[model samples]
Target chain A: MTSSTSRAPVAAEGTRARLIDAALDLFTHCGFAGTSLQMIADQLHVTKAAVYHHFKTRDEILAAVIRPAVEDVKNLIAEASAQRTPTARAERMLTGWVDLALRHRALIGLLQTDPAVKPHLKEEQNASILLDQPRDLLASHLSGPGRQVCAQVALLGIVGAASTPELRELDDETLRDLLLDVGRKILGLRRPRSS
Target chain B: MTSSTSRAPVAAEGTRARLIDAALDLFTHCGFAGTSLQMIADQLHVTKAAVYHHFKTRDEILAAVIRPAVEDVKNLIAEASAQRTPTARAERMLTGWVDLALRHRALIGLLQTDPAVKPHLKEEQNASILLDQPRDLLASHLSGPGRQVCAQVALLGIVGAASTPELRELDDETLRDLLLDVGRKILGLRRPRSS
Candidate 1:
């Protein structure tokens, strides 16, 4: 057999991703608890053994799906950390965070709401660190105690706006305006958009 | 042999509410697919058999948990439907929504995220109608073309702030300001916290 048939998936476009995509679709629709290995297998038309050959269990699969999404958030934090200006950093962070959230709205939705996984997702090992990085970076430049809270709240407000299906009904332009408008308010701002 | 132990749990609390509570706790912590009846049973100090006796399957348990939360949102919609003032109705709707959400943040969190049970929670017969209530309420008051979308993004922004751990981390006063501010901005208010 060629190497393609023999290699285990560990790249951007591999069996692992395919499994995650299938699982995400099912998990999004059926629920994480509602979905099964067999279901994932069924979605892919592959054997459960084949699915297991990559992920040891469902939790591992769940973890795998969250990793890329979590990394995406981490990357945003990294970009935010790189900027020197508080205004630029805050603006970049908000835009990056919202874009990532809107792109992976489903995963962000799960992170925010899914009761069982919320804590697990936020545990120190997972997205918790990713979450804190921004807080820490923003905190470094912030002036007062309430200011940190404001920044955190502002960024989260943007994420929530981007990820919520209630917001999904919005057209892109309206959504962007709402996000930017809401962002300014959270930051205790009344600046014109072009500012 | 008197069945006293069994009777206490049965008669003292409504079985439906108990099951919903247990499932909500587990669902919030584990993600729907990750949670099991045994886990819910563990929380309730009952057996899987008892859980099954109450809910035919985990799906039913999931349904029961989201039902009340979703209904609360629907009630807000009805209440908004009765109000004549666009601003007042939006305020009333937002107020009722915040009150309802704050009461059971965890359940609302679960209903919002967690891919496992998301589909089932939307309800077949009355799907999106309850969701549309706020959008409609917003559209009635706001005359813009994408007002519906604006309303949705705003509504979600409130919900996201209300339930997020990010928001939960803030002191009550700050959290409240952020939420109200975001809401008013969504409504396109000139001064976000007038009331």
Candidate 2:
């Protein structure tokens, strides 16, 4: 599969991007149920037909909006799995996951919190598998008894921390440092010796 | 303000309690938007009018469902605030908060994740105040610069960890211990000297 960077060329510009942007803002604030295609079009000062030409339905718009982030996750899992050791894989996955989550904090928050967005997002073919792939991969690298639970909780902590409104004020770097610090501790993984 | 235990006698049993219980289950599983008063009544094998008599609207039913937990938070903050030292207060608030969170994991998850329940829950008088009180209190007890952010993230970690599907399999005692363990580490609070 192509990396997010490579796929960015196809869906990274024009009215498609604008619709995605507007949809995200509305979805984040008003929620999926609260937002309508007309609202998205109105926000962009475009006709409904203009918006409809690119995406036929609200779910299609949502699919477009989340595509890049999901692709990045797919790429992260692929890269991490390619690592030779479980430790290396876990470290890579943790850092990569944190980076992705921070970069798209609002989208991540919506996905986690908004019920309307959730069912539609899940309907995407392979969405569940894609979502669980990294989690399962991360669980494999977690050591000791109850590592599965530990891995899951550790991930929950990282994702939850990143999505919090209170931490929104912290710059990406500061937030990343704190999240990685706590996340590593939760996962029982020490800092890489080389770092 | 009445404690959760003291107020239990008021709305603890009978139709009110049953309605709240059924509403919470439907809300947790089907979400607030997906669940209707009819469905709630159906779940309890009662007519919609029976449910409506107890709760005039879905929002009112939601209010009842969340009231006990919200009250418990209020009591937790009040109790924690009575403590003299920052460490003591933070420890008390942390433990009590975790205990309450574990006890009502599904409701807490719905409150945190479901958007439909949020606005209705927020409409209750003092809802925002009740929600922020514990957070503000927790921040006060947390020391050093950046404590607000730290306190917020720590609470998120605890709530998020407690609500995790993976952690659901573990017994309540084990979950509480693990949550407290990570919660303390996140808040920068050293374990209480006695414990």
Best model per lDDT: 2
Q: Write the per-residue lDDT of candidate 2 for residues B38-118, one digit (tens) a residue.
A: 998788766676666677788888878887887788789889999998778888888898898787788877866575665
Cα-based TM-score, every candidate? 0.64, 0.78
Candidate 2 stretches with Cα past 4 Å from truth are A1-12, A29-50, A112-116, A124-141, A144-146, A193-195, B1-12, B29-53, B112-116, B124-150, B193-195
**DockQ, candidate no. 1:** 0.21
Per-candidate Cα lDDT values, in order, are 0.66, 0.72
User: What tens-digit string does per-residue lDDT give for candidate 2 at A95-140?
Assistant: 8888987877788878765757765755443433554665666666
Off by over 4 Å in 1: A1-72, A98-129, A135-157, A160-178, A190-195, B1-16, B30-56, B112-115, B119-130, B138-140, B143-150, B169-178, B188-195
In Å, what is the interface RMSD of model 1? 4.9
